[model samples]
Target: MIALLSAPSNLGLRPPQRGSVPGVSKAPEALREAGLFRRLLDDGATDAGVVLAGRYIDDDDARAPGHVRNEEALVDHARRLADRLTSILDAGDAPLVIGGDCSLLLGIGVALARRGGAGLVHVDGHTDFRHPGNSDECASVAGEDLAAATGLHWPAIADIDGLAPYFAPQRAVHIGHRDDDEELEEVRGIIGLVVSAADAAVAASDDLAASVVETAGTGYWLQIDVDVLDPEVMPAVDSPDPGGLGVPELTELLRRLAPRAIGASVTVFDPDLDPDGRFARLLADVVVDALRTLGTAV
Candidate 1:
């Protein structure tokens, strides 16, 4: 069975404007309104309820390195999220986590680390690899989550409960980042498999599935940042670079890849940019269609 968990956290992102909280926090409710949950429930997925987030403390021109915004609150929320995920796993249900932003990876990492580890398949338009070592603008956890998850960031968020390196670098596969990504070269050296969006869009789904499956061992966690969709198709993300996958291509890849993963998280879709709820409905359709075959293996 699939268990849908809503993690409405915007704490990971910088503010769209000064003094304003990011609206990605509304993503779960937006997706729900678009019938994502209803369709999943009809298809045998269970509503695992929500993991509420701490209030987002905006980072307005604050380039304070190593000073992650909402440090205490974000840590607390992650720990609490871990507790909830633990229960969902205990029930033997595959988790479909809907996110407010990518920072929820911290919590997911905590849960997976406690579960004896799993491979990570990161599908994003950007690497999310900004760390103190590479950049001074490391305040947004959403953009730096991969670094935090792989234990390349500060000890505070990266080493929660002393479980640093939530997913081993050698067991991780990163797909869909653009070739021009600033962190591409560096991430490639650290991550086991790194595929650019251009390459991933052209590669056979079967081949992509084999790479992730072989590296994932017995179980794996799939994480999707919706910006992987071309801005023409999905512009609701915090950062929408050009040259991304089309909806059909993304849906095909997910169909081939998501089924074998133990759980998945969909992140960075902001309903504020989707005022008419068009993109939300479209994303919902794509997700519901692709994940309906959740437990089927490659």
Candidate 2:
């Protein structure tokens, strides 16, 4: 069984409504509005499809400045969210979380850690492991999520619910990163694998079943930040990365991978950065396809 949860807000960065990134869909909200759970429940009853345990994180509103600025609060909220997600995964169910931001990785990592060590396949344009310190770059806390997960930087992040530094450095892989920065060193410092954009596009589509099987063989938790897709294909994401994976490649990858995991959770962040619904639809298809593919593995 797999449960779909939506955590659709950045506790730190609150964009306006209908402000999805260019290529990704804002379907999470629409799914809620359209009574998606009822439809899924009905579908499951008829088809014995994967179960949908729909949930949304109801924490301090994203717009609350205190919540936004409080690192302790953000980390705590992530821990609580992880606790809920952990219950689902612990029951031999996968969790597909539609995220509020990349920050949701905090919860996902924590949940996976409790269940047992899970490898991470992080598909994004940034290495996400920024060295922690006082600097202009350190102001935006969300930027360093991957870094925090690898057990570097902020004490608050390192201590989330006492699950500090949630993932193993060697087990973490960064895929589809086109833009490079100082953070690359941080990733290397943590000894995370760097899978380049060209390699991702090639691997995500070609022989994806093999790729998934091989990757999953290592026991991984896959997390895709929509920004990893080219801005042309998914333009609505915050800080869209140029020249990255295409939709078909990404879809194929997920379709191939979903079946082989011990458990999996996914989060699509920064949908409000998208202007149209095209990106949302693409992301939704990826979810639908991944969920459907699980049947083949059964």
Best by lDDT: 1
Clashes of each: 0, 27
What is the alpha-carbon lDDT of model 2 when measured against the actual structure? 0.58
lDDT of 2 by residue, 1-298 (tens): 5566666545433233334222122435644444443444444512112212223223334534322234555666677777777676555555666565676677777777776667777777676665444233453345677777777656666556667567777767677777454566556556546766767777635464454445434557777777777888777666766778787777776666666554454444444454555555566655565554332342
lDDT of 1 by residue, 1-298 (tens): 8899999999998888888888898999999999999999998889999999877776555546567988878999999999998998888788899998999999999999998888999999999999999997788899999989999999999999999999999888898898889998999899988988899889999998888788766468889999999999999999999999999889999888877888899999999999999999999999987777664552
Q: Tell me the lDDT of model 1 at 67.
A: 76
Query: Candidate 1: which stretches are off by over 4 Å?
Result: 59-65, 296-298
Residue 60's lDDT in candidate 1: 54
